[model samples]
Target: MELNILAVGDVVSPAGVKYLRTMLRKLKQQYCVDFCVVNGENAAMVGLTPSHADEILDAGADVITLGNHTWNCRDIVPMMEDCPYLLRPANFPPQQPGRGWGIFETKAGPVAVVNLIGRCDMAFGPDNPFLLMEKLLPQLDTKLILVDFHAEATSEKLAMGYHLDGRVSAVWGTHTHVPTADCQILPQGTGYITDLGMTGPARSILGVLPEQSVAGFRGELTSRFKAAPGPCKLEGAVFTIDTATGRCVHAEGVRIHEN
Candidate 1:
C-alpha cells in the first residue's frame, strides 16, 4: 500500500494561517493525502501560541512541528503537554514541557513523526540531534517515520538526510524558509529535501517585511519585526511512502501562490 503524506513548511503570519485554512483541505484532496504535518513555529509572526496551533490543526494539520522559536510563547509550553500532536524538538532538555516525537494512527497505518533542531549556528543550544535520534529511532515501533529537521545550515540538514536515509521514510528540512531545488529519494529509500520554504507572504524576506529585515541587517532598526502584507504562498513537499516496505517511493516539492 502507498501512503501519501504532505509536510508543510513554516507558517509565518495571520495571512499564512488564512491561506492554510482556506486551501489545505483542497490540497489534501487533490493529492489524495493520507497524512499531514505542518511546521508552525512562526505561525504567530514571532512565536506560536495554543490558539495558533489550534488554527493550524483545524485547518487540516494532523501533526504540528515547531523549531527554535518553540518557547517564544509561554502559553504553548502547557499546550504542548496537552496536545499530543504538537511537537517541539526532541533534542531539547528532557524536562521540556512537550515531547519531541509522536506516533499517530492514520488511515495508511501508524506513522512516527519526529522534530529535531540543529546545533550549529542556531540561536538556542540543544543536545546533539544526531545522537538523540540514535536513541529515539530504536524506540519507535513503526517503520513509517518522518522527521522535520529544522536547521539554518544546509550542510547540517544534508548530513542528517544521509545519516537517516535508510532508516526513516523521509527527512524534510525547515527554518531556512528558502526552498531548495534538490528533492529526491536517497539511495537507501528515504525522501529528502534541504528546506520546505515558508508558507506566508509572497513579497517578504523569509516571511518578514523586506524593509524590516533589511533595516535590521543594516543595523538601522531596533523595532520588532512584522510579517509582510500581500498575497500568501504555501510551500512544502508531498511524499509517497511504500507502506509495505516503509520506504519512500516518491517525493516532490510543492509551491502554491494564493489567488
Candidate 2:
C-alpha cells in the first residue's frame, strides 16, 4: 500500500487562511492525498488563533503544525491544550501548552507526526531538536512517522533530514516560506525537502507586502508586517510512501496557483 502525504508550508495572514479554505480540498483530491499536515503558525500573520486552526482543519489538513510563532496569539493556548490534532514544536520545553507530536489513525494505520523547531538564528532557544528526537523515536509506536522541521537555516534542515533518514517516513522543512528545489528520497529511503514553501500571496515577499518588506530592509522601521493583497497560491510537496516499509518511494513538489 502506498500513501500520498501532503505537507504544506507556513500559511501567512487571514488571506492565506481564506485562500487555503478555497483551494486545499481540491488540491488534496487532485493529488490523491491520504493524509495532510499544514503549518498554520502564521495564519494570523504572526500566530494563529483557535479560529484559524479550526479553519485550516476544515480546509483539509488532518494535522496543524506550528512553529516559533506558536505563542504569538494568547487565545490559542487553551486550544492547544484541548486539540490533539494541533502540534507545537516538541522541543518547546515540556511544560508548554500543547504537544509537539501526535499519532492519528489513517487508512494505512497509525501515522505519527512530529513537529520540531530549530535553534540556529531563530532568536529563541528550545531544547535541542536532535536530542528531543532521540527521546521521541523510541516512544512512537508507529513506523509511519513524519516530521516537520520548522527552521531558518538550510544547513540545519538538511542535517536533520540526514539524521532521521531511515527513521522517519518523510522529513520536510518549513518557516522559510520560500520553496526549495531539492526534493528527493534520501539514501536511506526517507523522503526529504529542504523547505515546503508557503501557501499565501503569490506576488509578495514571503507572504508579506512587498513594499513593507522593502521598507524594513531599507531601515524604515514599520509597526508590524502585513500580508500582501492579491491572488494566493498554495505551495507544498507530496510524498508517496510505501506503507508496508514506511519509506518514501516517490517525492514531488505541488504548487497550485489561483486563477
Error of 1 at 38 (Å): 0.3
Q: 100 in model 2: Cα distance from truth in Å? A: 0.5
How well does candidate 1 score on lDDT at residue 115? 99
lDDT of 1 by residue, 194-251 (tens): 9999899999999998988998889894588888999999999999999998899999
Model 1: residue 75 alpha-carbon error in angstroms:
0.9
Report model 2's TM-score to 2 decimal places: 0.99
Q: What's the lDDT for all of these models?
A: 0.94, 0.95
Q: Which pairs of residues clash in candidate 2, taking residues 3 or more apart in a chain or in different chains?
A: none
Give TM-scores for every candidate, taking all chains together and pairing residue i with residue i: 0.98, 0.99
* Residue range with the least summed lDDT across 10 consecutive positions in model 2: 221-230
